[model samples]
Target: MAILPKLGRAIYVLLGGILFTHLGSYMLLPFFAIILSTEKGLSLGSTGLVLGAGSIAFLTGSLLGGFLSDRFGRRLTMVSGLLIRGAGLLGFIWGATFPALFLTNLVAGVGGGIYAPGAKAGIAALASQGTKTTAFSYRGVAANIGVTMGPLIGTYLHTRSSTLLFGGAAVVYFVLAVSHLLLLERDCIGEDCPKVDRQGIRQIFTDRPFLYFSFVTIFVWALFTQFALSLPLRAAQIESARNIGLIFTASAVLVILLQGTVTRFFTKYLHPLGTMAAGIVLIGTGLGSVALSTSFWHLVASAVVITLGQMFVMPTSDAIVADLAKPEQIGSYFGVAAFVFGAGEAIGNIAGGQLMERAVAIDYLPLPWLLYGALGLLLGGAYYLLRLWQPLAKPLAPVMEERTENNPSPFRPKQKT
Candidate 1:
């Protein structure tokens, strides 16, 4: 409600779309392994492979989506992604064989990949500097809400009918595609549009500072991903599966309720880079604290600390990316961010699994948490040092000036240099 006045209609629409997209995705994607193993009678290894392949497909799709959104337009790219995703979800209805399931997973992954960068770019394009962080924070809240609620609904639907679960997700995506088509405007179009510079695109990969930022991002994601990967495993070992669910549920709820307030405080009091560094440190502290947990309450407390760090990290990271990007290259930058996220998640999954397994083998349960926590602390320190050595690029002033000249608005605040 408070966000409505700060962000315009376009931003509101994008936020709504994000909410539904995550809801639809989490609703079905979380249950894929179960569906594959139980219904299709696939081996655990095969299920893991299918899921792993899907992650690759998603990353590939993110790259493609970024390029396409830059070449064409965000609206077109986003709509196309939704349509593809819808088709992929529809495929689940008849996905009896391994190949069918794998193919559908690939399609769905690509679709999500395509949609994400465009949406992020759209938000950056629509929001002014003053409201950008808030916009992204709101986006996080919406996503958290979806994450919190989707699985609960999915469980019920899953118990009743898998068709309804997958089919409903398909319908959600299809409807989103249509909504995007009707409601969203094309970005980076007409005479004022920047030329598609191939060299500039190449520079994105070579931009040392940007790459460094992305490098830090990978660790951030990897550390954060432990919540999904390692935390649950630890929870199971210590307590029960229900405890695992409660841990995540508490996390989602905390994020949804506190993210905005936390983000606002950080934005008001701290510089963006400072916020990020602090967040990383908090994450490390939280993870490290997990090593000491002997009860469910301790884990919950750790999660709360981690969730606070998350509230700071996620939105600030996005806002920083937006600030660093040229107006024309917003989509491409976000795409790169998505790719980095996938890479980080993969590392988290693999390294976390290995660490967990090794710790268990050695009968030292605290080792993995300590190692992850140390890594997080080191990464956070690295990030802060990098910030000192090479301050992030400022928003492109000339482009902002041009936009202001072309379409002057009293609402647009001057960006700090």
Candidate 2:
């Protein structure tokens, strides 16, 4: 509600695009491994390899997408990414073999990688510093709304036909792509856009604090990936597929309902780094609790705990990245975050699969989750200590001065007095 007044047509459009993209993606992606293992008869390790390959491709795309968005413009980069993603989704319809699935995953991962940073940068470009965090929170809410709905529909469609499920998702991406082409305005123009040269690229990588933050957050992302990588598999062992969808739906619903309130509370009381640390602990606790879960309700409760942690971490992390970035380098900064995301996911997929396989083989189902939980707690503490040692850099007022008549771009560099 507080973020409403800050919403313009462009932001609204971006939010819509995000909502649909996630909806389409979650509809099929959450079940991808299940389909592979059950129907295609791929081993869990093989499935993990396929997924990890995609994540590697995604990281590669993040770098390319970030630079491309900076050089070309957000609108063009987003449109192209969406189209490519749609094509990748369509590929799933015919991907019955492991190699086919791997190739499709690569294509989809690259497309998603390209789209994400551009969209985040577009949000940064449109939002003022005062409203930036709120805007990103709303963006998270929109994506969660999609997450909430996607699994429910996907469950139904999957029961009917895999083709319908994958095809439907492809349609959503294609439609959003068209909408972006028609409605989204270009954010970068003329000299207002920062030229992303070799030096700028190097500067981004060499940013010590930002790199540290990203590195620490990588563990969090690894834990986050378990929702798709390990949780569903765990749930399937104890519950029906429909119930697994319900668990995911419950998590998303909690985020939709509580994200705004949680974000505000944390922002008002805790430093951003503190917020991140606390959120990570909650996530660890939730995932750790999964070892004790025995039924559908128990899984849902654990997911709810995880969602609460996400409410704190997701928006705060995005805002922190935005704050760290120079206005002109927002896309590249988010790109770096995306790269970290991809790396974390890759590690999670490969490692989680092996952990699950070994645990099941040894009849020790709780082993992987307990280990995951411990890692999360340790990383969370490390992050909190890092915060104490070196606080995050606040936005520089002179560097990000507001737009004026002479300075048309909202993010233009301030002139010396």
Candidate 3:
């Protein structure tokens, strides 16, 4: 009971910061496709090339960021990343040229890449035993909050000036940077923290279980990327841009409302492996259902199913990463996972786009979707097998005498006897 307030405060601060960061990021995401095509007069191929550069840079940056987080500290790495991201956003206001835009994306991608591992690792480090899953679920909820609000706000600003929207995102990043530097304590450092020899990407690969998990999740991430890459275009085919936006907003709202309850329910009743597999199956089925959609209502139902699957998998996956990682190497594990995630999304966007083109060319879009759905279900079955081979790892034994009734401040450094 006594620990509740402190735990809640920590969670609130982290969640609040994440919400603002995601809000700023999403505000610009919707503008990218429209701006590149209409304002810059770029062909679809050229637009893809420009966008793909950022994804590549971001994956590279994730590896570097993970190393830095493990070597230095999470708070410092996060603050530095946010500041770099702010500069990238500011660049968009002055540099409207093609080369400038590409450079802006590269810099911003690196910044985002650096921040992710540190932020996720810090959250895991701070979360109490038995609560890491819940903590990550809250993080997902925070993201949904930002996703819901930021684009709506951007839509209004976008009508006035793209410059204004860009500036707004920059300001938000700057504020988040300052807040992180001032408010986030270095819980990932200090004497109480684990002292392990620094390991690199090589060590990450040696952990076969984690490697396998990352491999499977790449396909999962690819499936999720369809929402950004192909789902909108499909929606646009049937409805106006405004209606498509609303459909997305509704999906975010669904996740925001239901993520916590769903996460709790699944975690309580199901094995993490089973829960994740079920979620993946739902995502694939939801996406495949898109082939059958002839109206807005059908797409809406598909989105709900997809969102529910996401609600199940996201938090559980993060928790699984935390569980697999050694406390000191959490950032590294997350970094590797992020790299795989970025790679999957990048591949998904590029491949999914081409597949869509081919499918549309043949006038049989359902073929590609059916194949994707089968892949997802097959992957889920594979994960079940992997779970049997390598059961989830347990928490590390604490270095200090744990606090309870006798010692209330468990987080404080212990004294010499």
Candidate 4:
């Protein structure tokens, strides 16, 4: 076997790994609440509490995963999380009740959360200089492919049995876990990945650009979470199964096709903040239109419009992070961004359940749609606030290998902001 083709294959493998794992892991997000509340015979209030248990574990695992990625490097982290998630998914396959699922889901969630940084940092290391935007865009393509496929697995396999569906997923996870551990090279962790200097960890939080951009990610992702909850539930009511499928199909294919192009466009005209606001406003518009949806095509149209906005925004956010992060600290920064996403996912799932399933009646307040809309407004408000100061972190190319009376890690001399 030629070395060059093998290397190319390995890079695609890692990118594919990120996508597949995200597919198996999150395919349940939109349906987990509905499954329990409607299928498993639980009250909405009870179901919310159950899902919350798993999310707590997931977020906790995400934080620990980041710190550990700093200390242990990316490969070990990836192997461990894959196996751990596989086992928890097996639990979901076997576990028969709320109590059983609560622990099992959390276990799987933790495993999934822990592995995210390794995937991202791995890709960062793999890219050649000046290709960071395109590289991250490619990673998004893999991830969306995973997202698109995982749901199909759930939709078809679970018709036979939920246990069989999870069992099948477990098999995929186990095989991928082994392939990753055996095949991937060490250098894929990136130069920054293994270096665990926590000296600037505290200050990364205080960095104005990082902080504001992270907030942008939080809301944009929260809006995306509606795909798992609000939008799907609404679609099931208003749209045909084919139309629902079309929405995601459109989103996935569009993202794969347009993310790189959109990132390049942003390279010239729009900043990350602009991209985020534009994407989010489209999501908000999509969500509001979903509220008005009465037919399948209406929902398909909604997915297309919102996803186009996603193409405009998502890769820009990832590119901006790469641009702003100090060369030595890229792993830690990307890890932090991934962790923020996990945290938002937890909140979005639990809160969405409570709002949509009204008869269980937890609070003395109004309905779920009201809450979802207000939350969207909260996202819009944050976007404007982000607009106040930040503008694309101003990309600095990946050069700087030359010694300037110094070892050319030039961003190092600067004190932490």
Best by lDDT: 1
- Tell me, what's the RMSD of every candidate? 5.0, 6.6, 6.8, 7.8
Q: What does the lDDT read for residue 266 in candidate 4?
A: 52
Q: What is candidate 4's lDDT per residue for 1-417, written digit by digit as tens?
A: 441222255667787797878677656654667777776777888787787776767676766676666667767787888899899988875566777777887888788777776677666666654455556777777788887787877777767776677787887788888988888876435554445666677778877778777866776676678775666676665544545656677788888777766665654444456556666777766666665567777777777777777776666666667667765566677778876787677667767766666623664222454455565566766766665652432343222221122233333475579
Write model 3 residue lDDT over 1-417, tens digit each, in one string.
Answer: 342224466567778878988898888888977887777676788677778777787787787787778777888888888888889878877776678778888998898888888888877878886677778888998998998888888888789888898898989988888888888777555655455464544677888778878888998998888877677777776674457777778888887888778866765555567778899988888888888888888878888888888998898888778878877688888888888888888788878989889988998867767877887788789777775773332221121112122233434466679
Candidate 2, overall lDDT? 0.81
How accurate locally is residue 267 in candidate 3, as Cα lDDT from 0 to 100? 55
Model 3 TM-score, 2 decimals: 0.87
Candidate 4: the clashing residue pairs are 30-228
Better of 2 and 3 by TM-score: 3
Error of 1 at 9 (Å): 0.7
* TM-score of each prediction: 0.92, 0.83, 0.87, 0.75
- Any runs in candidate 1 off by more than 4 Å, and if so which? 1-5, 188-194, 391-417
Q: What digit string (tens of lDDT, one per residue) describes model 1 on residues 230-296?
A: 8888887887657677878888888888887787577655656667889988888898899998888
Which whole-number lDDT from 0 to 100 does residue 260 have in model 3? 72
State each candidate's clash count: 0, 0, 0, 1
Taking all chains together, the TM-score of candidate 4 against the true structure is: 0.75
Sort every candidate by TM-score, greatest first. 1, 3, 2, 4
Better of 1 and 2 by TM-score: 1
